[model samples]
Target: MTALFVDDRYRGAHGIGRYAREVLGRLDVPWRDLGLDGTPYAPLDAFRRVPGPGAADVVYSPGYGALLRAPRQVLTVHDLIQLQTAWPGRAKFLAYYNGPVRRVVRRAGVVLTVSETSAEAIRAWLRDDSVRVVNAGNGCSAAFTPDGPREAASDPYVLFVGNTRAHKNLDVVLRAAAVAPGIRVRTVVPAAEAAEVRRLAAARGVAERVEVTTGVDDARLAELYRGAVATVMPSLLEGFGLPALESVASGTPVIHWSGCRAVAEIVAGRGWAVSDAHDAHEWAAAMTEAARSSRTVAAPSDAYDWDRTARVVSETLSDVLG
Candidate 1:
């Protein structure tokens, strides 16, 4: 069967965008790209405007382009963070989720998710046993290897990669840095959020110990990963923790919250999981111990390959088409 892949998030730099670019690049099927432009809602417009998929063709979206109506469509839902978390745009998000997103889930032939945890969440939220949800997992990019050139920091620092979303629980890191002393916390965030992170650090009384860097390229990110004492992920929820995997691949230890099952499962033997994400003292002790100990290194398993992911997608689509 032929595939019509939706390239909606191709130009974006978020995890969903990266996933789209990676899997679409390695897919083994004969496929054509359908690009979407304008706002985040543009996909709906594109979906309505584009010609419908033929009987032998399947329309696949790596991101949640669920509004698109096609003969056979596959959607990958990363997480329901907006639904679960309390945010400023809850009203708008709820409206969209209840409107187009729910419609997409109802109409999709097969729904793919990043982890089993996410699959369960989707099933539980939708309360639908008929929905076909599968776990496709995630992989670290090949660039984050153990032999990369390391970046230099004035003092040993624990690295935090990802946006400063409320669920990320960065306040714990700031609190831990305040009490830990001597150990710096280096956070990679967008330029717009740098000031807010700094303000939070000051509010927590650890401004001097916290350093925030914005707009780092991949090479720099790898270097930082290589040199960090340990990468910290205090997120309360995650579909599939990519940062933890990347850190382990770079020969750096990772300390993530145990509450995030996906992160815990991904970093099982290669990293440490703290049971109490809210306890600053516990995280502080863990960070200090990680800095003093030898870096724990491990290579990603064969399962973390884009080729494997593509194969799974291909097989799933074939099953749906059959």
Candidate 2:
């Protein structure tokens, strides 16, 4: 059977986009791209009205873009953070999740997730015992090796990658930086939210110590990872901690909140998972210790590899088609 993978989120720079690009690039199956355009939500709307595939064709959506009544449909639900986190868009998010997304997921032939933690969350949230939620786990890109050109920064800095969303717990990082004094925080946020992140830093009284960067390429991100003392992932929830794996892959340590079950589980015995995620003093102390330490740890068992991930996906799709 021919596999058609949806490329709805590939044009963006978010985690879902990264996952789509990397895994899709490595798949060995007879596949074609069903590309979508416009904003992130457009694909969902489009998918609902889009034509169904032939009997010999299988449709795969790598991210959350699900189809209402497609036969032989596969979906990858990265996380159920929206269902768990309290955000301004909670109402709209609930409307969509409880409406179209729920219908699509219930009809999916196979459901792929990044982590077992997320798989459980999906099962719990959907309350669907029959959904085959497979934990395919993510891998760090080969480009994120230790021996790379490091980014140049004036002082020793803690790296924080990803968007500065409320669930990211960046305020804790800023507060920790403020208390740490000597350590700097280099945050990679989206260009649009840079000003707000900077304002947050200023409000926390660590504006000078916190450097917010926007629109960095992968190579630059790898460089930043290599040069950092430790990567801070104080997120309240994570389906799979990509930054933790990438940091370990880049020969840098990771400091994450212990409450983030996926991150804590992934980084266990590889890096530090602070029990007190909300206590700035505790985070500051951990940062100080990480900065002084020169030890490099091995990548977690779940370290990202697109080829391996694609192979698993290929097998899963084959099974579904059979």
Clashing pairs in 2: 139-303, 139-304, 139-305, 140-304
Model 2 poorest ten-residue lDDT run: 43-52
Candidate 1, residue 217: the lDDT equals 69
Q: Give residue 268's error in model 2 in angstroms.
A: 1.7
| Clash total of candidate 1 | 0
Worst 10 residues of 1 by lDDT: 37-46
Q: TM-score, each model?
A: 0.88, 0.91
Q: After superposition, how far is residue 79 of candidate 1 from its true place, in Å?
A: 1.7
Task: Identify the runs in model 1 with alpha carbons over 4 angstroms from their true place.
Answer: 1-5, 41-48, 51-57, 68-72, 87-95, 320-322
lDDT, candidate 2, at 110: 57
